[model samples]
Target: MAGSTFVIAGQNAIRRFKPKDHIFETLATHVDQEMLNKPNDLAFDALGNLVFTCPGNSRQEPTGYICALQPDGRVTKIPEHMYFPNGLAFAPFEDALIIAETYRHRLWKGHWNASALKWEDAHPWVEVGGPIGPDGMAFDQAGNLYVAIFDQAQIKQINPQGEIREVYPLSGRRPTNCAFDLSGKHGLIVTEAERGEILSLSVDQPGFPLFRGNNGWK
Candidate 1:
């Protein structure tokens, strides 16, 4: 939840809803009047820019893109072209972006370019698994990245040094997404798509803090 409202990826749109509000608001639909590909997962940069992945479809070439809901209420592409871009998250200490090129089985690292509103050094950082690659991801307060390995029935924990620290086994096979609870109660929570269950695990530390939302978050 960001900025007292919940924003979610909807069909060809970014939608927002508030508690007690019966109608959901459409935040974005297109960029430069061109219809957008269906938005997949969502993220927020350190600057509080609402970011999301739009992977059109399965294709031989990388055609998916990442977009941001800017402060001006405009939809713009942060970085373009990827192979079925899936889950994404911003690093806590910097404006750097960590993305999952799911189909390519690669995890990418990039730095934000505020001037151009894009990423620099947008290249593969490491290789995880094959065809069914990493899905939704999150970072802990300690800066370690936790990635859900689809079809692998595990969440791989990789330290900042790119070293694998742990392979957290799960009951379900397909884990779609994961998040760290800001509250002191729950540590890490995951969504298992295969059996339709929500799972949680205790952690040593809480999740890294995130910018509240895109609009007037500062």
Candidate 2:
């Protein structure tokens, strides 16, 4: 599905799009009847469940939620009160879900039990400094949690022991997401607020240019 591109909650209300010809097919118009319907990030779980975040109607309206779009085109809410949940990932080697609360600068973790269709074991994973504006997150093999601090122009590494190890500075000011390379020694970072550029850096050489633009991130 790499070639497939979907514009979420657009004016036309399309759900799926194929990029081969840049064709957007409307799968659900007014699909999100419950919320304001602005879609956010999407990621797949280990079981290939297509999970998505939509911080609809601000924090005032009771619309934003973490939802999973089933294979049969059914949408179900997993958890409520996510508060502009931005980034997510299945923890290092566990089934637990790690969510980045964008506005709260906090990390929330929970477990998904299929029978319940709702998340439980909710708790704070980590909370960064004032308005660090946390975003995309990833985990290293060593169990170190790496968070892209949006406004801080840095990446904060949280070790397995719950220690905030080091703040690695970045050339870009607003890093929105991050992912480790296949080798696990480097990272691919993306900035959203600034031109939507990407950067690649090593775990050791935290500061220099390993790559830039889209070419560097992959």
Candidate 3:
């Protein structure tokens, strides 16, 4: 997984691709039936376990859930029921996982219990204003969060205190997801889904390099 690329499809499937041989392998399919109707976004834990969000029907329903895909191919649905859970990310230097509830315009945090292999102590972290939809999210080295405001053509930066610090406008394009480049140049890359293009923005703060945990694969 350290050298592979993982992708999630709208058809309710997750695939793993090997860059070396250009081989594509099915990691999970028909996962909707096993979890929820839609699998939105995913992130890997410190131990390489896949954590994903399922926002069923794109509404504020209890049908939404957070799920985990273990290394052994086992799927586990987390015990919390959410309303349209969307983008999620692991905290930069904390034992926490943050998730966005698109329909509610809020962000929630959950403590990761490594010994139990689950997330616990779930609570609301932030309440975003306006009618903008919160989608994909990423964390910076300073523990700040950058969330893509879907349908609003902007990205909002939330500090560790869960307060909106800055709102950056994207060139009139609907952004669906965002992440910091791995080049250590502190450039933020956003997906302009409406135009089928990727936009990059220069930032003063560098992002936390993902997969840097002690348990991460070398």
Instruction: Give RMSD to native, each candidate.
Output: 2.1, 6.6, 2.4
Global lDDT of each model? 0.80, 0.64, 0.79
Q: Model 3, poorest ten-residue lDDT window?
A: 209-218
Whole-structure CA lDDT of model 1: 0.80
Tens-place lDDT digits, model 1, residues 146-184? 999888888888888777788899999999899988885
The candidate, 1 or 2, that scores higher on lDDT is 1
Residues 21-86 of candidate 3 have per-residue lDDT tens digits of 799877776443653457779988888778888777757466787788776776777855677888
Q: How accurate is candidate 2 locally (lDDT)?
A: 0.64
Model 1 poorest ten-residue lDDT run: 209-218
Residue pairs with clashing backbones, model 1 = none
Best-fitting candidate, scored by lDDT: 1
Candidates sorted by lDDT, best first: 1, 3, 2
Relative to the unseen true structure, what is the C-alpha lDDT of residue 8 in candidate 1, on a scale of 0 to 100? 57
